[model samples]
Target: MTLVTDPTAPRIAIVGATGAVGNTLIELIEQRGLRYRDIQLVASARSAGTELSVDGVAYPVHAVEEFDFAGVDLAFFSAGTEASEQWVPRATAAGAVVIDNTIAFRMDPDTPLVVPQVNAHLLDARPRSGVIANPNCSTIPLVRLLDGVERRYGVRQAVVSTYQAASGLGHPGVEELREASRATLDHPEEVYPGKEFSPSLAFNVIPKIDRFLDSGFTLEEQKMLQESRKILGLPHLDVTTTCVRVPVVNGHSEAVWIETQGVVDRAELVELLAALPEVTVHDRRSPHEFPTPATIDDPYRVHVGRVRVNPNNPRAFWLWLVADNLTIGAALNAVQIAEELIARGTL
Candidate 1:
């Protein structure tokens, strides 16, 4: 891993610095000791002048409008779609390569939706559009772990059920979950203003995640299906998913079933997953230990377990996968995009 340290080290800007994903992005930059000549933190007007410290250095968060992107080599947009839609083009027009975390550009034909460990070379190819999009939290880890399998055995179809955390909705959602849990514990009649979730998130699961689409799947489920295909470059792939919101605060977990063109055994699948970089296979059976949210919190690697051949279909198998939603699912993916761009001399 050659680190770029030229005097021209890219001037990077992080949009939505006050939000959950944006905060994690800042932490990753400091934790990894990323070498950048300059760093700019941009947030909405309300968060302006707020100070965020990294490695003992304090940086002030500036209002997005006042932050000039003239020389910024890379800008990460973690703000919502409306913000990304409004500012991403402006930043790109100013000659900055934008890696957006919002859905604003993920499905856009011109923008490459990338998960670095899986389709990083796509980033090296220099997108036709200046902006590159990161897939949704549910889609990122799923695609990363399945990329090799899909390519080697030819995935024909998939069915996924997600156990998403409250943090996926950002700060307010986290607060709602926490308050709801406390209220339930205290035997309160009402927890939130209205139902914070479709059902009581405390000690419960809401079968719906994002808004329902015409196809009867939530927007999040559709994103996982469509984006997974796009990222893998498998247009004809058959995929179905059910996204559910859980009370967990951070990590996202999923139970996935995949059908392949050829017969694949559990041992072979385990070997393939274990060998892949940035993936951890924990398929122990003696004590019944497997990847769980409590075990995978804050980790960068995607954890896989319960690898088993489907009883009904010899060509299909099932597994459990977990990953930190804020990091590998969003911020780290953006960072990897920036690193790839720099390595390929595209930034």
Candidate 2:
């Protein structure tokens, strides 16, 4: 394995710079005060020559196909799966570590699916085909909050229902939802086709997320199950999920129930979560406080609340978790991967 020395900041590249998560990634990179000798933003040909401003400085978005990756030390890819499949290898071959945010390489054994707070050690292991995969937006926060509980008392099964925002589908979905709401208020006609959603998302909640599979689960639900197992290193864990699309603009929330092998005390669980780094526990019910999508927007911390033992199941508990999908879910995880590489002197 080849390693780059310390004190020399790496050259970083962000694919799909104009996209929602891509823009958030750049904001985080600057906010964290990360030191990179050079930063390059790449997008599709249609968005080429676009200028994105960071800290009052403008950077031009280049065409991905024509951008050279020769000197790039790391590439943060937030583009779709097809683009990642086509360009990640090219960047890797040019000696850049690729932290991919799409679903393309997630299930690949050669790629490490990671959430930094939960599995930072995964990055310490040998580089897997020069690529690392970030888990789905909903899955990332779920696993991070549940990891400690799973470690202390083994988790046998889980049931999750996701309240996803319009941002999960990118800018067009957000625009559609916003436009649909406006049109509905003014008049009564479908703003977007029924193909986009079975029911109107404006002032409505759709229980289905992504296309359904033969196994009677939507692709988004399956991703949560499969990715959770992989990240927790429990291949046979029984996980069931129902992913929903809500009218919220940002942040993803989940109501999770888990059955554990041993008893888990509610108070102790609350204390543990509060002490965990990057996790905030808000269990106060007197004032009716809890983790809400509106409150957790743009934050890296995953907030947990409503922790209690299930009334029916003796060894089961219920919890609520929320986080900014674009940050903690995608871009922040990618940035942490790069930070990990630098801290470990692997770059």
Best by TM-score: 1
Tens digits of per-residue lDDT, candidate 1, 205-309, equal: 889986888978888888887899899998987889888898899899999999999988777788888888788888744215588888764378898888889
145 in model 1: Cα distance from truth in Å?
2.1
Q: Which tens-of-lDDT digit does each residue in 21-122 have in candidate 2?
A: 999988888888777777889999999998997655788999999999998988999889999999999999998989999999999999999887888888
Candidate 2 displacement at residue 110 in angstroms: 1.0
lDDT of 1 at 48: 98
- The regions of model 1 sitting more than 4 angstroms off are 1-5, 194-196, 284-287
Structural RMSD, model 1: 2.2
Q: What C-alpha lDDT values do all the predictions have?
A: 0.85, 0.85
